[model samples]
Target chain A: MQIRDLVRRRTPLGWKQLVHSKGRMAIATAGVAFAVLLIFMQLGFMNMLFESAVMIHRQLNADIVLVSSTSRDFASPGTFPRSRLLQAVGVPGVADAEALYVTPRDWIKQSETNRGERAQMLMIGVRPDFAAFRDPEIAAQLPLLVETGTALFDRKTRGNFIPFRQAIERGERPQTELGGRTVTLVGTMQIGSSFGSEGVLIVSDQTFFEFALNRVPSAPSVGLVNVAPDHDAAGVAAAIRARFGTYDDTMVMTMEDFIEHSKGRMRRDSAISFVFTFGTIIGMIVGVVIVLEILSADVHDHLAEYATFKAMGFSNRALLGVVFEQSLILSVAGFVPGLLVSLGLYAVVRSALTMPIAMTVERLVLVFGLAVTMCALSGALAMRRVRKADPADVF
Target chain B: MELSRLSHWYGAGETRRQVLFELDLVIPRGEVVFLMGPSGCGKTTILTLVGGLRSVQQGSVRVAGRELAGANEARLIANRRQCGFIFQAHNLHRSLTARENVRMGLEAQGRGLPPDADERSERMLAVVGLADHANKFQHQLSGGQRQRVAIARALVAEPPLILADEPTAALDRQTGHDVVALLRRVARERGMTVLMVTHDNRVLDFADRLLEMEDGRIVAARPGAAAAAPVNP
Candidate 1:
């Protein structure tokens, strides 16, 4: 018979064997299920963490983020004169220039009125049509923010997730005056993402500076740059470098570089990658043990059958193929259900907890491939006893 | 087949006790011989040596003119395929039906049984008087039936030689003699050279020639043996 047919015919015998001994198959499947589940959990945690990190930077489309070289990252400060904004707009390939502001703030707890927690907020001064604090797609009319006393809030800031039921129930969500007029809470939505789940507020440059006390007067503005169409971001950065000539150790990070910088910052303390690694490591260890145990039991229970096969002149290679096929079948069987469970959990948590759980085809395929490979490898190692078995030995 | 000065010992190096002494003998094709001995007289050792199941140390054994003493692994395996072995205990894959067990032997000959493997297995089972029990597992069969299945397994490969080690040791006297008679009849009908190890002298009536074994050596043959002394084909 062709080897493939033998494997095909023989492994279903493995399934029959499993069915006849339901308890044994269940034990075997449990091992595989847990291993698959582990990999899924890892992917879930990683997606949530990585997507959240990149989302923060992906939503901001600045050409360059000029920060003080002495500043560690967005968490710290580098300030320059507001005149630098005019100089940035005058560059040859420049489209528009705007001053961006960022700093930490206190977000009053939604559940409790008396206590509030520290939350980092990105305070952008809306310049006629800039929806820097909210995704452009979500905002209906960006030009409306140019009014004298108005502000928009990014709902998905640090502990300040927007569906704050408690605050809505209390009938008070911090109404205050700004720029000599009542700044109304027209509407609210997410600005894609942030380093934390805290909230952010946007207003006109006049209203924001007048209302929020954190705006630095030590130096007028943070930094400025233009968004260009045809020119490479690096080229624009270079021109900005020539214009400023590294005065006060200024660091001109291109849009890509800024995104890369934010990613690095998030990665340094990435809780999601940690959770993912934790899951994968646990999965591998658990998978090895389960596969080893299940394989050992099947071989032991069928010692005489394997001995008969050997005595009947089937080579060790043939025996190994049969056993390896059995392992793969068990791995695949358990993985199907395990993956379904993981996907269900991800969907539930994504909608219910307001946290992201990314399910990419590439990652799903990778984890599936890994699950199969892990089973085959560990199963083969466990079945080494069969290959070493002597007909005379087993008999 | 020939054996020359072969011996085996059991236990560890220093504590070892010899089982088979240095012995010399020859078995020929188309010959049905029976060896009778008491327990622990090393009848098993001699059979194991001839079967290529033991490591040949002191001397040589040759089956179908292939040297067994210094034979490499490949040659020994090939020799084993040409011989069919029936032991006292039935060694069958319990998960497989009686037919699959028999077909497994046929499979070992590098032949996939035809689509009619089941029909062919039924024929072999009928030859051993087990056609009615052909679909049952070994555990479902009586001791006599299981032994019949094992005999069917031995013959299914169409081996040139057949060896039975106490083939009926677990059965009643009548069943034991019946199996012995069946073995003799198959040997004569199919031209199989058979060597059976038995402690039961009652089964000796079916042997064409009886060789008495004592102290790991075949001490005597039938009274008219010298004239049959060519020893090889």
Candidate 2:
């Protein structure tokens, strides 16, 4: 049969039944919407966690990155020999290689408003001439780091640094104590904060050795390699891995793989990912139960009517169509409000925490698919009651 | 319609009790027959069996040239489509209007709604003197009007037979008489056979034949008051 003819012939019995009682429809819609909202929130937070963890990796200028094999994540910066970077430059397709020294150090806030307030911040030391960041604004400020005691500050840092930031904004160099030595903040970079580090400070390699007393100059935390034009970064990374195959002290990977590895580590080692995933499953369960209750009650309320339909020659499958239609209607009706509310909540969280949380088309489609599946499951369970309607009972 | 040696029981082996004894009866086409008896005399059981609402346990129930004995669920449903049914209370769906309720009769034939179902339902409602109340819900209609709508629904599909159980039992005296008269007129006009079960004596005169039952057996059968003079068909 043609689609139009089929639709014209079928009575919208489910719609009429649902709209018969306005109060019940409203309650049912609200119940489904609440569950949808819960699922959206959990999924949104989980994506944000992964996005925040890889914010810095996405901004790095290197096509390939080399890290210590013992390093678990950005927080655990196990050092390797600086000579590894020198050796990497001799390999085919290697354009340039640079050494990056990273460590967490106590920064004594030296603003008149909050003097001597110490905060732990990540410090990155690099050669002044090397392009260390993909952000052009940070790259432009690299030349200022050529002077000793000069450093760049991350403006998106998490803690209270309003006074220090304002001082830099006014073009006045603000002096802050790092490792008990005063350093001048010459510029600001916009690399946002993550769960691992609340703030970042960048200085030249010469000043890095003066502040890090326990570290040797020959050992750097990371090796950055830029592939020459027309050379694939993955191939170069593979060659680097082959060159260091027997050496267990360092690991090499393409930048894309490095970002994924970081995200995978967070997902595997952090309880937050599990908590959010569990919450999402719980939301789906709650949705199924609520829809089942609504549909079961609707069937119970109209059992006699269903029996009358049976007596009139309706088959069990025909009766089930009515219920499944109701479930589809509820899923669509509830999903709209749930999605709108979630968007607003995502905005609130994005601004409040400076976190990389935003809506994507994939997430929207996934959640909608989940909502439909949840309602369909409930419809199947509720159909058991509809099949019990006996035609003879109507008499 | 014919019923031969029909017998039925309720419950399992331990608590079994016979409800219908071995009975024999035949209802010719276009005849309006009423089955009357005291309570617990199998009046409704006969209607259920003849309507294909219940399985015929023992003996044969043949309606519209189809045997219902040992019929599968699908076959029984097909048989039901050829018949109409009315209940004691006007079991109209409250969610639908009078016209929509009537249309359900045609829609329930295991086919989708017919293309001209609206006009057919409206015409059927007009036949039953309910044209003005076609758009009104069951709750909006009075008790007599609801019963009339039920009659419209039962006959809208133009079934070959109609089986009603206490169709006018919930209506008042005058309303009950008008409803039965309407039913008789419509059934006669359509050349449809009807088997109604009722205890109301006021509406008994509309039937062409009356079968009186006692203890699951037909005690007496005779022509009704209307049998001698046929109504204008």
Candidate 3:
């Protein structure tokens, strides 16, 4: 039958039934909205967790990257020889390669009011002329790092640094000790913090060796390679990989792959992702239970009316359609408030964690899809009760 | 409509108890028949079987030339579309208005609504003296008015057969008489067959034929008060 004809045969039975009891409708809508809100928050946290893990890798200004084969992730990346970067520069479409030294150090926050408190911070050492960072603000301030014993602090760091950041904004160079050596904060960069480190400190390559007393200068943590214009980074990366075969200690990959690798490691090693996914499933289950309760009660209330419909020659499928329609209405009515509240909560979480968590179109569609599926499943289960309506009993 | 040696039972195995015992009856077109009996005499069971609400377990039931003895669910549903049913409780959907409740009868046939379905429903309501209460929900209407609405709903689709079970059981004396008189007049005007089961003696004059039952058997058959007198008398 044509859809219009099918619709014409229906008398808005589901809508009439729902609106007949205003209080029940409100309760059902609220219940579904609560479940949808829970699912959205869990999904949001899960995506942000992975995003924060690769925040630094995404900010690096390089077409290709080289790391030690033994490196697991950013938190514990092993070092590779500096000679590999020099060898990489000789490849056909290769631009200049820069060495980046990374190490975690304790910063002694020695303020007059608070006795020396220790905070673990990430330290990145780079060349003053060729700092491999994508942000223009950080690149412009790289000249300040040319002086030894000078560092640029990350402005988006996660701990309590209000006084230290205020001092930098006031144009007063703040003095802090890193790994027991005194250093001055010359400027501030805007690389946000990740789960591995609460803050980042950028220093000159000479100062990096001075502060990292156990590390040698000949080895670097990562090699950043830029491709010459009009050449493909993937091709250069393939050549670099061929140069450093399985026997070599270095691993070559495009910058995009490097970021994905970091995220993959985080996903495989962290239990937080599994927790968030479980939370989403739990939300869906709660939604199913709520919808089932509402629908079952509705069917029980109107059992005689449903039997009368059956006695009047209405098929079982048509009767089931009425219940399904109610479910779909609840899903749509509830999703709007859930999405609105989730957006508000997302803003709060982003500000509190300094993480890159925002509502995307894909996530919105995904959560809405999930909500519909949850309600539909409840509708299917409630149909069993509808099928039990016996026309014989109505007489 | 015809029923030949139809038997029905409730429950299974050792708990089984017979309700209808090889009953035989035939109703012609455009006739209004009443089946009257005390409680548990199987009057309502006969009405249910003829209406295709219950399966005929022992014998044959033919309504509108279709056999309903061993019909499947789909066939039974199709047979039900040819008949209208009125229950003891009126059974009006509280969510729908009087006119909308009447319109449901036409929609139940699985055909899209006719272009003039509203006019038909309103006209049916007017015939039953309920035109003014078309927009009122079931709760807003009195007991007698709800029964009239049920009658309108049963007749709006113009089915060939109607089966009513104590349609006036809940109404007052005058209301019950009026309801049956209206049903009789409409059945005669439309040439529709009706089989009603009732214990109310006040409405017996509206029937053309009356069958009295006892112990699942038809004990007597006679002309009702509305029938013409015998020539020899």
Best by TM-score: 3
lDDT of 1 by residue, A1-395 (tens): 67755542332345545665678778878878888888887877776765655564555646676666565445444556555556667777777666666554443443233234433455555454554433564356455565655556555544434445333324344444433335544345465444453445665666666555657433433454556678777888777777875465566778678657755666675565666677787887788788778878877787677766666566666677667777888878888888888889889866654566767888778878878887787778867888666666422
Off by over 4 Å in 1: A1-16, A61-94, A112-128, A133-137, A141-185, A191-195, A199-261, A268-275, A393-395, B109-123, B129-135, B173-181, B223-233
TM-score of each: 0.82, 0.94, 0.95
List per-prediction Cα lDDT, in the order shown. Answer: 0.68, 0.88, 0.88
The reply for model 3, stretches above 4 Å from the true place, is A1-7, A109-117, B229-233
User: For this target, which candidate reaches the highest DockQ against the unseen true structure?
Assistant: 2
Error of 2 at A255 (Å): 1.9
Instruction: Give the C-alpha miss distance for residue A23 in model 3, angstroms.
Output: 1.6
Please, what are the lDDT tens digits per residue for candidate 3 over residues A258-278? 888988887888898799999
Q: Give the TM-score (vs. native) of candidate 1.
A: 0.82
lDDT of 2 by residue, A1-395 (tens): 68878886878888888999777777778877888899999988898888887787788889999898876666566899877778788899999999888888888865455678887778888898999889999889999998898899998887566777888868799887898999899998887777777778889989888888887768988888999999999999988877876887888989888888888888898898889989999999998999899989998888898999899888999899999998988889888888998999899887777788898999899889988888889988999999999999988
RMSD of 3: 2.7
- Can you give the lDDT of residue A239 in candidate 2? 88
CAPRI tier for the interface of model 1: acceptable
